[model samples]
Target chain A: MESKPISLMILDIVSILLLAVSTYLALVFAPLEAAMGAVQRVFYFHVATAWVGMLGFIAAGITGIVYLATKDLKWDIIEVAAVEISLVFFLITIVLGSIWARPVWNTWWTWDPRLTTAAIIELYYLAYFMLRQGIEEPGRRANFGAVYALLGAPTIPLTFMAIRLFRTIHPVVVGSESAEAQGGFNMTADMRTAFFFALFAFTVIFIDLLWNRIRLGNLQQKLEQLKLNILE
Target chain B: MSAQREKDQKPSAGFLNSVLAVARKDLAAELRSPELLLAMLVFALLAIFIFNFALDLEPALRSRVTSGVLWTTFAFSGTLGLNRSMAVEKENGCLDGLLLAPVDRAAIYFGKAISNLLFLLLLEVVVIPVYSLLYGINLFNPGLLLVVLLGSVGYIAVGTLLSGMAVQARTRDVLLPILQFPIILPMLIASIKASDGFLTGVGLEDAVPWIILLIIYDVIFLAIALMVFDYVVEE
Candidate 1:
């Protein structure tokens, strides 16, 4: 395998540094939420991770469409990288949301639409991997993966809307105070700064990880092709 | 120009005929064997029985739980029917023969989907009465029946498309539900809600949105499956 590029090395360093800064901003710079106390602090990272997850999901969907149109294996690699990153980020978002919900909602979990949709989206991602694993031929595997990703992509928005329409106790912090009854709070300037910065930091980390993953996928493909050639 | 127009019109007409031809093939084959419907009905009965024992299904509880229990039975057995429907095509090499026929691929999709819908409806026809007889809840209401039909259309639309893809994979049987369940969650939610409304005699205004959502899901997925069926079945 080729060594990591110098630019990626720089990005790796920058991502770690920004993560540290964002953690400090979240942990110290933001005021302790009056209503929920320390547990509320998890919201910064929670929303940030969810933001990255959404970004990765959209990327996967677009790449899936492009792969279908162009029939290129490269787009498939990028789609998988995007999905893998989103899967990890969404996991963090769900766990953090659950932790923050415990003290505030007086329950470990709520059937809030957002949480439920997140859980469902996680299942879609898992099923994506399982579908890919079951296909032995690389080209067919990529084709099936892209098609499945495309079909599965719309569920995220529809799920969000369905849950929103059904009934939602999840806090809609960024918008109007609709969820005030459900422990939604207004963000002060400091909290906003931390919140937005966490979003920025996570976006950077997401790009950094996505680049590394794509490179990894390329390497794996190359290794497979090499093995085939040697056997022939 | 006249000859070209005739050629174009011929294929469009052929598409519908081809779709029906495929559906008829599946229906005739299934009638001869009768195994798919038999399995689905038995499985639906078992699922209802399990729910009966598990939920205690008292008279008061039966009304509230009927929609959920019925939809769950349909969803589980629906997968069985879908997997079997596609697996039969694969096992008998019918898929390759269908593909080699000079028909629009979407015709094959519609054909399989319609046959799958018929099998599921057949299972529901048998299961619903059994459920009612055992629980003593009259489930013959017109509105509830409409809800069941709409819900099954949405389920079979997506289930047919996904099962077409799943049956091509190595882990064919196990992959369908995993690929299907999360995507079909909205349909299940809407179906259960709409069925509950109809069974409880709620106002049409109250149930309209869920019914509308079900219709929208059915249309959207049917369009998507038609457009993408070519990619999935292509060599």
Candidate 2:
């Protein structure tokens, strides 16, 4: 595998810098939330991580479809990279959400649809790895992974709808007219800046991590080929 | 021209016949041995018994918990049936034989799915009455039965596809449920909700959305399984 490009090094530095700034903004710049107090501050990182998670989820599905269509191993690697990054980001999202929920909802967990769906999505991706591990042949493994990824793609939206329809106590942060009325507070200007900056920071970090993981996958593939050649 | 006409008609007619043929083959094999059905039935009954002890089902609480218990048992036993059904094909080399046949690959998928669905429904038929006998609650609600049917369709549709892949893996049996459960959760949730509504004598308005969701899950998964089965079964 080639050395890390200069651009990626710059991205890594920028991402780290932005993450520090984003955290500072959330912790210090944003006004303390009236109802939930300091715990509500977790919302900035929570939503930003969830946003990055969603981005990875969509990328995985799209790359999965492309792999299936083109029969390209590169796309398979990209799909795996996307799913891995999404999995990590989503874990953060869920944990942060739970932390926020503890102070606000007076419980560590609630069966809110978003929470339930997020948990299920986490399990779904974990199962993706399990399925891949059980297959020895690379092509077949990639094929099954792509098919499973495609099958799981629809579940994300459907799961959200199912949970939303069932019932939801989780705050709808944006685009709901009754947000403020539903125990959800509107973001102040400073909070909005922190929130959007967090989102931007996480997107940059997700890309940097994904690029690094793809390189790792390429190296792993090369090593496997080398072993096969040596054995022959 | 006559030969071309016959060839054109053959595949279409052959498709349905091939599907039924595969289904019949599995049915006949199961009838001869009865291993798959017997195991699923026994396992399902054991699950219910375990649930009875685990939940400490008092008479008053049984009605409320019955839907959840029944679906859980079905889902667990369904995975067993799915794993075994596909494993049998792999063990006997029947999968390769089926692949070599002059039929659409999707027919094999439909055939396997139908057989798996039949096994689940049969288990439900016996288990429901047994559950009713044990709990003394009437389990013969049509609405609940419809939920069971739709839920099984949705479950088996995806289960068949996943098991087909799972049975090919090194960790064949252990992998199906892990691959299946998360994806099938929505259907399970909807089924349970619909079943509860029916059991509690809730109005149709409350249950209709769940029923609709079940149907949507069934149709969407069945279509996807058919489309993707070719890739799954490709050597």
B33-144: candidate 2 lDDT, tens digit per residue: 9999999999999999999999999998999999999999999999999999999999989999998776778788989988889999999999999999988999899899
Clashes in model 2: which pairs?
none
TM-score of each: 0.96, 0.96
Scored on chain A only, each candidate's TM-score is 0.97, 0.96
Candidate 1 lDDT over A1-232, as tens digits, reads: 6799999999999999999999999999999999889998999999999999999999999999899889999999999999999999999999998898888898878787888888888999999999999999888888889888988776667666666666667778897766434989889999999999999999999999999999999999999999999999
Docking tier of model 1: it is: medium
Which model scores highest in DockQ? 2
TM-score of chain B of each: 0.95, 0.96
Give me the overall lDDT of model 2.
Answer: 0.90
Give candidate 1's error at residue B73 in angstroms.
0.5
